[model samples]
Target: MPVTTDLVQQVLRLANEVNAFAKQCGRADLSQTLVEVAARWKETETTIVVAGAQKRGKSRLINALVGRPGLLPVDADVATNCHLTLRRGPVLSATVHRNDGDVEIDPEQIADYASTTGDPAKRRDVLGVDVTMDHPLLDGVRLLDTPGVDSLTLGHRQATVAILQRADALLFALSAQDQPVLRHELEFLAEAMERVQAVAFVLTKVEDSANAQALLEENRRRLATFVADAGRSSPGTAAALAPLLEAPWLPVSAKLAEAAAAQRSLGREDRAAKLQERSGMGPLEDYIRACAGGRELTRSATVVSACVSVLSSLTAVAEDDVASASEDGAEAARRLAEVDKALEELTRTMRDRRRHAVGNQFLGREVSAIVRARLARVRQPYEQAISELGTRAALERYLAQLPESVEQSIRAAWDDIVAEVSRLVGRALNEFLAALGLEPMEMDLAKLSMPTVWSHELQSEPGESAKLDLLREGVPAATMAVTIGMALAHLNPIGFLIGPAIAAAVMSRRREWEQVHRNQAALRRLVSEQFTQAAGEITLALEREVASWRVAVEETADIALAGQRKELEARRAELRAPAGRSAADRGQARRRAADRLARAGELTERALALRGEIGPAVNALA
Candidate 1:
C-alpha cells in the first residue's frame, strides 16, 4: 500500500490504540515510548529562514513571496531589528512576543515593531514577531525573517546565527548591486550550511544592477573557492554543497514583484501577471515550496520507521508471553537463570567492545593526525597577517579583530572534525550491533554545545617582557560527559551520535616597546606560541568528543539489551502466575495470551506494509 498523508494518519491512529492497550495491560515503558512519538508527530511545522547582509532586501523578498506588498517594511538605510515568523491562519493578525509579554497588533503594523526605525523604546524590548495571514502557502510552512548578517549590533548578528541552528532550510539573499560579496558573508554562509541542510541563493535587486549575470558568476566562483579553502569533507557538508552549487541562482526583483501586486489590486490583472513572471518570484516560491514538501516527507518517513521499531518490540513481548503461558515452573526458572547469564555476558562484551573501539578506532593515530593538519591550517593566516602588516598601528588593528577571526576559524575546524567523527562512530556502531545479532539502525548525531573563546584578553603591558599566561578549562563535564546509564535512559533524538566545541584562553604579557623599535619577528614568535597552546586544547577537546561518542554507542547497545531483558522478565512472571490455578483458569490465561499475540501480529503487519511504502515515497520527494 502506497503511503500518503491519509495512510500516515491511519498509522498514527494505530499507534494511539496500541498505546492505550499497553497502558491498560500495564506496559508503562511502551506507553511512554508512544507518547514521545505522538509529541514528535505534532511538531511538524517547517521553518525556512531568510538571511543575508543588512539592506540586502530580505524583507522585500519575503513580502513578494507572500503576495503582500509592503507587508514587511523595506528601506535602503534601515534593516529588520528583530526576527519575524509568517504563518497561516483564518484571519490576518500579528503578535509581538517581547521579553516581558506578548502584544497583539494589526498585520499592517508589523514594520512598526520589527524594523530598525520603529518605536525605539518598543523595539528595544521586542524579541520576535509572529504574523498570521490567509495565504495558502503558509499552511504548514513558516517564513522567518532575521536580522542581517552585517548588523552593526553584535547581538543582532549573534541572534541570526543562533536561529540558524534550528532552522530547517535557508534562503540566502545576495544582491547583484553589491557585486563582490564580503569575506564575512561567505563565512556566515559556510557555517549556515553546517546547520541547515537545504539552501538556495537568491540574487536580489537584479533590476537595479547593470550586469547581474556577471555579479552572480563572480559570487559562484568565490563561494566555490571558499569551500575548497575551508577543507570541509564531511558527509553532511557534501550533501549541503550539492544543492548550493547546482541550484539555479534566482535572479529576482522584489521591487517589481511588489509593483505587480499593487497593479493587480487596482484591477490591472494581465499587466500584473506579466510583471510577476518577469520578476521571477513564481519560481522562487516554487523552490521554497519544494523544500517544505521534502521536509514533510522526511518527517513522515521518520514516524513510520519509529512505529515499525515499536511494533517489533510489541511482537516480542506478545510472543514471550505465549511461551511463558505454556512453560512449566521448572522450565520457567531455568529460562530465567539463562536470561540472567546472558545479561551479564552482554554487559561485559559491550564494555570490552566500547573500550577497544574508543582506544583503537575512534581517536586513533589517523584522526589525531587529521586534527593536527587542521590546526596548521588555522595558524597559516595569522602567520601571514603578522608578516604582511608593516605599521605597528596596522598590527594593533588586526590584533584587535584577531579574537573574532580565530573564533570563527576554530569553530569551522571543529565542525569538520565533528562530521568525520560522526562517520567513524556510525560504522563502529553498525559492526557492534551486528556482533550482538541486532538489526542495523540509522542514528543522528547530537549537536554539541559551542564554548566561547576568551582571546580578547591579549594585551601588552609595560616592562612585562615576553611572558605568556594561558588558562584553559575543559568543557564542563555535566554537559559533555554523562553516565552511560543516564544516556541510555533518555533514548531520544540526541542520544546516538556525538559533537563538540574546544575553548582556549590566551593572556599575553608583552613589554610596550617604543614605536621606533617595533619587532615583527618577535610578534610572529608570540603568535606561534599562542597557537601551540591552543593546539593542545584542541587535541584535548577532540578526545572528549570521541569519548562522548563511545558513551553514546554503549548507551544505545545497553538500551537494546535492556529491552530484551524486560521482555524475558515479563514472560517469566506470566508463566509463574498460573502456579496453583485450576485447569479452567490456566486455559483462560492461555487464550488471553493468544489473543494479545494476534493483535501484536496485526499491528506489526500494518506498520511493516507502511514502512515499505515510506522509503520510496521519501526518495521520490527528495
Candidate 2:
C-alpha cells in the first residue's frame, strides 16, 4: 500500500504517546528527541520545479497543471527571468522581490516582475515572484516555475541552476518541436541529478507536432544513453539518475488541457472529457501526485528512523539502569566507574578529532588556500583589462562589467567553502556518533539550509568612489573632443606640422593613464575586502554549526547519566526503608516496577510495528 499522510500521522501519534510516557518516567531528554522527530514529519512537503528551454511553453504547462487557464503569463516575445513560486492560500496574492526591496503586485501583473520585457525597472532588478492561491492541487505541494535553462541571458541560467539545486523534484518540460535534447539541457540535467531527489520529463505542445509518441520514445532512448555516459564520468550522478531513467515520459498539450479544464468548469462534460483524453493530461497529473506522495513517504521514513534510534538507545539505557540499581553497592559502584572511564576517554578522543576536522580541515590552511586561489583568479582578468585600456570609454566599459565579475567569483568561492565545510562536518559527526557507540547516519549538507554569502549591499569602497570622481572631474569635455579630433587630423599630411597640439594631447593622455592606474588599484582593493568579509562570515557560521553538534553529543551523555542516577537513588531509598513497613508496601513497589517495564515493552513493540508497515514503501521511494 502507498504511504499516506494518515499513516504518517498514526506513527506521529504513537511517538507522542511514547514521549508522554517517557516524561512521566522522568526521562525528559528522550522525550525531547521524540518531539523533534515529530516536528520533522510535520514540516515535510514536496517541492517541484518546472524548467525548460526558452519558449518551451513552461508557463502554459504550469497553468494546465493547476487547471487555471490564465494563472501564469505567457508570451512569445517575453521570457521569464525570475522564479515564480506557487503555493496554497486563502486568497490569491503576488509578491515581487527586487534588489531594492519587495513590493506587492496584482496577480495579473506577475509578468511585469517575472518576465524580461514587463517593466524596465523591474526587468533590471527583479529577483523572484511568489504567488498564492486557493487551489486544491497546491495543498501539500509547492510548484516553482523557473527561467529557461538555455536562455541567452546568463542571469536566467544561473537563477534556474540555483533553484534546481534546492528543489525536491523537477519537471523538465520539452517541446515536441525540439526533437532531441540540446547539449545545454543535458548538462543542466546532469548537474541537477546530483542535487534533486527526483526528476521526470514532460513533452509539451504535442498538438503542434506530428507523431508525438515517436518523438517521446526517441527522446527517452537518447536520455538513457546520456545517463549512461554521465555515469562513466561521475558515478554519483549515475546513481542519482538511475531511478529517473524509469520515470514516465509524458506527452501533453497544455493548450488542449487548459481548454478541457475550462470546458468542464462550464458544465460541458462530454466535450471536456474528450479533450482531456486527447490531451493526455490525466496520466501526467497522476504521475505528479504519485511522485509527491513518494517524496513524503521517504521523508517520513527518515524521521521514523531517527525516532527509533533515539528510543532504542533510551530503552537500553533504562534497562541498564534498572539492572544496575538492583545490584549490590559494590557492583553498582564498579559499573558507574566503568561508564565514567569510558566517557572520559571518548571525550578526549572526540576533542582531538574535532580539532583536526574543524580546525585543520574546515577552517584551516586548506580553506585559506581555496580563498586565496579564487581571489587571485578574480583579480587577474580585471587587472589585465584595466592596464590594457587606452581611452576613457574603454575604462568606463571595464568598470561597468567589473561588479558582475566580482560577484560571480565571490559566489563561486563561497560555494566551494560551504561544500568543503559540509563534507568535513559530516565526517566529524559520523565519527563522533561512532565514538558514542551509536550507528552513523548519513547527512545531506544541502538539506541543512546553510546561508548564502552573496549580498547585494557589497559594493565599491569610498576610496574607489573618490578615484571615479577624480577621473570624471579631471577629464574635460574639450580635452576628450580634442583627443578624438587629433586622431582624425593625424590621418592628413598637413597635420604633421601641428606639433604643439600633438604635445598637449600626449600630456593629457599621460594624466589619464595615471588616473586609470589609481582607479584600478582601488577597485582591486574593494573586491579583496568584499571577499574577506564574506569568507569570514561563512567560516563563523560553519564553526557555530560544528560547536552545536559537539554540544549535542555531550548533552546526550549527560542526560543519560542524570536519568540513571535518579533511578539509582530511588532504588536505594526503597532498600533503606524501615522494617516496620507492611508487606503490601513492598508488594506495591514491585508491582510499580513491573508495570513500568511492561509499558516500555509495549511501546517498543508498537514502534517496531509501525516501522514494519512503512519501511517497504520508504525504501521503494528512496
Candidate 3:
C-alpha cells in the first residue's frame, strides 16, 4: 500500500517547522539536525528522569526496585561511572552502557565495567559505572541515571554538560542538607527544565532528617523566592524550569537498604508502636506511591507508536509524489502515443491526397500549345519533314500499334504505379515548351498522315511512253529490307551485312510513308524526355516534403520529453525528510542509559533519552 498525501504532508510540515525554527535559532550542521532527530524521538518516546544527589539513597531506591544490589554502582562517595540501562525483555540479560555503543562485560565485574576500554583523560574509556539492574519499572521501559550534577570531580562538569543535551526528563534529587537553590544546581535545573517537560524532585534521606515536613515546606518557599529572584520565576539559572518546579517533590529515605533491613530486623515490641510501624517505610512509601503515575515505559511506548506512525507514512512511498511522476510519465507516454497515432493517420491521409492529386489529363491541352508554338520556330526544311510525315501510312500503322500495346501493358500494371508514363510524357512536353516560350499544337495534330498503300495511274494514251517498265535500277518492293541492305553495302564496304542493313533502317522508310516516319520519330524522343523530367521533378519534391515533416515531429517529441524529468525530482525530496533521523540522538540515548549505574540521585536524570533509544528498537523486535 502507498503512503497517503495527508500523511506525507503532515510529516513534511512537522519537519519543516522544526528545521525552520532551528534556522531561526541560528544553528548549523549537526546541532540543527539534532533537534529534528530529537523531535522524532519525542514523537516516539517519553522523557522521564529519576534523580537524586549522592548519598541520598538513590542507589538504594534502584536496588529495591530491581531486587538486587551491585546492579548499580554503590561506592562510598562521589560515585562516578558509566550509566547502565535496563531494558524490557522476557529473559534477563544486559548490554553494556555506552553512549556510542555497547560492549559485553562480566556480571561479577559489573562494578568495574566502563562505557569504553581506554583511559578517561583521552575520553576513550567508560568511567566503569556498573548500571545494569532488573526492576519492574525497567520492564518494557528504558532507564538511565546521571552523575550528581554539582559534583566537584574532574569529569563532573563535562559529564553534566554532555548529559544536558539529552535531558528529556529530570529526576532532580537532593537532601535537606543540600539546598536545591544553589547556583550550580540551579544552573543544572535550568538546563534540565529547558530540555525536558517532565521534572520531578526527590528529597532523599528523609528518615535521617528530624523535620521532614518543615524542610519540605522550607525548600518550596526557597524555590519560590529563588524563582522570583531569577528575573522571571526561579532566579539565577533555573528560571526556565519554574513551571515544572511546582513541587514534584517527594520525600524518601534512600539512606541505604541496609537501614531498611536493619529497621525490619528490630524487636516485635518496638514494631508494635503505630509510629514505629510507619518508621522505615511511611513517608517514603507515600512519596513512591504518589510519584508512580502508572508506567513510564507505557507512556514512552505510546509516543514511540506515534513516531512510528508518522515516520512510516511520511518517510517512504509518498503516493502523491509517485502519482505525480506516474501521471507525468503517463501523460508523456500518451502524447507520444498520440503523435504516433497522428503520424499513422497523416501517412494514410497523405496516400489519399497523393492519389487524388492532379493527373496528366491536362497533357493534351499543354502539348497542343507547345507543338503549335514550336512548329513556327523550326526551319522550312523541318516543315517539309513534318508536312511530308503527315502523308505516310507506314508511320501511321506503327503509331496506332504503339498506343495499343503501351496502353494494354500499362493497364495490366496499373496498380503498381501512381500515373501512366505515356500520359506523363505529354505533360512534360508542354512544361518544357512553355519554359522556352513556345505555343503548343492542338490535339488534332497528333494524327500524322502516312501512306499505307501504293497506287499508280496508267498513262493516258496507248501509244505514248512505250514500254515504261516500273522496275529500273532498284526493286522498290515494300519488302524494303533488301533495298536498305544494298544501300548500306554501297555506303560501308566492310561491316557485316545485317549491321549496316539494321543501321540504315534508323533513317529508312517506305516511299509511301518516309515523310511520316522521319518527323514522328523525333517527336517520340521529345515525349520520352519530357516523361523522365516530370517524373524526376515530382519524386524530388515529394521526398523533400516528407523529410521536413519527419524532422518537425522529432523536434516536438524531444521538447515534450524534457519537461517530464523535472517534476519527478521534486516529489522525492518531500518523502525522505521526516523518516531519516540523525545518529547523534541514538548515541545520546545509549550514553544516558549507560551512565545510570554510578548516579547518586533518587531518580535518574536522562530516563527519557533511554526511552527514546530503546522503545523503538524493542517495539520493532516485538
Candidate 4:
C-alpha cells in the first residue's frame, strides 16, 4: 500500500511540476503569438500563446501556419497596445465583440479600438477585442495575439498579463534580437516557469547573422544557463526545452512566410513566392510540433520533483540541527524548524530581489536621473533675477542727470534776457503787493532777485526741464514788479495806489536789481551746466560699469561654486548604497542548505535530496 501510494503521489507530483514550470516559462512572452485555439480538454479551452518581441515576425509566422492572409489581422489589426485572440471553425467575418454587443469592425476601422469616438455599432472599445476567421488551424487551436512585451507601456502590460495567466500551450518566440534576456523578460520567465506546461521556443526575424545555426545554439546555451541559475534544472525533465539552452539559434523571416501565404492564395508560383521557397520550413514545423499540445507526462514529472524539493528542504533543516544524535521525535522537529526557516529566507530573498530588479534597476534609477537633472537648474531663476536688478539700477542713474545738460548750451544772451524778463516780473509783482491792500514802504528793490536768477535756478533742477517755465512764470512775476516801479506807474493811470508805489520802487532800483540778478543767474547757469554734463557722462559710464559688474559677479559665483562642491559630493555619496545583494553570501547559504538536505536524504534513504532555503533559514522534508 505504501509503495502504491508513493507511486500515485510521484505521478501527481510530476504532473504539477511540469505544468508549473511550463507556465512560468511561457508567461514571459518575449516572443511568440497567441490565437484563440478551438481545442478544449473539458473546463480549460486550449489557448495557444505566442510570446515574443516585435520584429520576430510572430504575426507572419502565425499567418503562414494558418494559411490565411488576414486571419489574425497581422498587417493592420495587430497593434502593440492590446492582446488579440484568434479563433476558428466557420468563415466568420472580422467581428469585434464589445461588452454591449458584437460589432463587425472592418479591417479599415482597426483604429477604433483606441479611438476617442466613432461608430459604437461598428467598433469595440477598451473592454476586449475578438478577431476570428476561417483557417486550417482554427479547428483545434486558438491563437493569442500577444503584444510584444518589449513594446508595451504600462497600459499594454496589463493586457498581456491578463491573456497569459490562463494560457495552455505557449509558443515562445525567441528572436536572435532578444539576447541577454532583458531583465523584464527574465522576470516574467522566472514566474512562468512555475505555472504552465509545454514551452517551446521559436527564434524569429533572423535574415542573416554570423552563423544562424551556431547563434541558435548559443541562444539556447544562455537559456539553459538561466534555468541553472534559477534552480530549475531537473534531470527527469524532457529535452524539448533542454536543447533550447544549447542549440544553434534558428532563423526565421516573417516576410518570407507572408510571401508564401500571399502566393499560395494567388495560384501560380509568383516571383514573391520564390523568396518564401528559399525559407526552410523544417525548423518552423519542428517548433510548432514541440509546442502544439499539452505535455501531461512531462508536467506530471515536474510536479513530483517540485513537491519533493520542498519536502526534502523541510526534512533536512529539522534533522541537521539535532546534536548528531538519532533521536526519533528530535529529527522530525528539527526538520520542521529548518523547513520553516528556509521558506522564510527564500521568501525574503525573492521579495528583495524583485524590489531591486523592478523597483530600483527598472524604474528607480530612471526617476532619480530625472530628479537630478531638475535640481541642477535650481540656481537659474535667482541668477536671472539678480542680473535684472543690476540693469535697472544702472538705468536710474542715467535718467537723474538729464535736464541740466540741455540748459547749459543755451546760456549765451543773459543780459537782454534779464531786462525783458524783469519788466514782466515787475508788473506782476506790483499787482500782488497791492492785493494785500497794505501801505507800501520803500522795499529793498536792489536786493530783489530778478527773473534772470529765477530762470537759472529753474533750469538747474534735475529732471525738471519741462516744468522750468512754471517756476519762471510764478516766482519772477510775483517779485520783480514790487521792486521796480515808475515804468508800471506812468504806464497805467488807473493803477491802484500800493501797486503804483511798488512799481516806482522797482523802476528806481532796476539797475541795482539787474546786477544782483546777473550774479545769481551766473551761479544757477553753472549748476545747470555741470549737472547736465554729469548726467550724460554718468549714463554712458553706467552702461560700461554694469557690464564690468556682471563679469565680476560671474567670477565670484564660480568661486562660490567651488566651495559648494563639497556639499554636492556628500549628496552623491548617499547614492552609493550597494546595488545588489552579495552573490557569494547567497551561494554559501544555498550550499549550507544543500549539505543539510543530503544528510537528511542519506538517513531517510531517499534517492534524491532537495533543499529549500529561505533567507537565514534552511529546511528539508523526507
Best by TM-score: 2
**Per-residue alpha-carbon lDDT of model 1 for 1-622, expressed as tens digits?**
2346787687677777778767765778867766764564455677779888766778888888888767777762123346888999988889998888999988777777888768777677788889888897887788999987751233455688777645666788888776466666776776664344456788898877889988888998887776665547543234334335654568899988988988999999999999899898888887767656676544454444445555556666665555555535455456657766776776676566555445435454555766678778888888777777765667667666766676777778777766775576556666776776555543323334444433534453212244322322233322333443346447764443322211111111112333313545555665666656566666566666556555655565667677776765665576566767776776677678778878877876775565455444433332
Error of 4 at 534 (Å): 53
Per-residue CA lDDT of model 4 for 1-622, tens digit only, reads 0224454454544334433432333322211111111112232234667776544556666766665544454433334345556676465555655567766666555445522233444343445456666765555456777765442122344456556545654566766543534434544444443333345556666655446566677765566665665555543232213322432334566656666666666785775567565554456555444333333322222232333334343453333323222323344345445545555554454345323222212222332333233322432332343234222233234223423432332232222232333343333333332332211111111111212221233333222112324374445644555434434557775444556456445544553444334433443444445434433343333323223322332333333344344433432232221113264543454454455545435422331321111100100000
Tell me which of candidates 1 and 3 scores higher on lDDT.
1
Candidate 1's error at 611, in angstroms? Answer: 20
Name the 10 consecutive residues with the lowest summed lDDT in model 3. Answer: 453-462
User: What are the lDDT figures for the candidates, one per model?
Assistant: 0.65, 0.64, 0.41, 0.42
Where does model 3 exceed 4 Å of error?
A: 1-16, 24-26, 29-47, 76-81, 90-94, 97-102, 114-124, 127-134, 177-181, 232-239, 255-622
Which rank order by lDDT, best down to worst?
Answer: 1, 2, 4, 3
Whole-model alpha-carbon lDDT for candidate 4: 0.42
Q: Which should have the higher lDDT, number 1 or number 4?
A: 1
Q: Provide the TM-score for each candidate, comma-separated.
A: 0.42, 0.43, 0.38, 0.40
* Per-residue lDDT of candidate 2, residues 1-622 (tens digit): 6767688787777777778877877778877766754554445556778987767778888888887777787772234457888888899999987788989988988877777657776666777888898887787788898886752234456678767544656788888875467655776776565344356788899987887778887787877887898789866346545555665577889989888888998999999999999898888777667656776564444444445554555565455444444423344455556666665655565455445344323434444555566556665676676567765566667666666766777666566666765576557666755654544443323323334654453354323222333455445534554555666576875453454466556656666777667766665565566666666665566566555544544454445445555655554443344234455654454455556666777776766666566554533432
TM-score, prediction 1 = 0.42
| Model 2: CA > 4 A from native | 1-44, 76-81, 298-622
Could you give candidate 3's per-residue lDDT for residues 1-622 as a string of tens digits?
1224443344344445434433433335423433543443433223234454444555555554454555565552223544544444555554554566666665555444532222344334554343444445543344455555532232443465455444444456666554434454555565454334345566766665677778778767766765677765423234333454453565555444444445555753443444333333344443333223322332333232223323222222233323223312453344445545555554454445323223333443443443333322322333344344465454445444543443343233222222232244434443433332233211111111111111111111111112322483133432354655666677775433665465445434443244345446554543344333333443343233223322332232233233333333333343222223344543443343233222211111132333344333322221
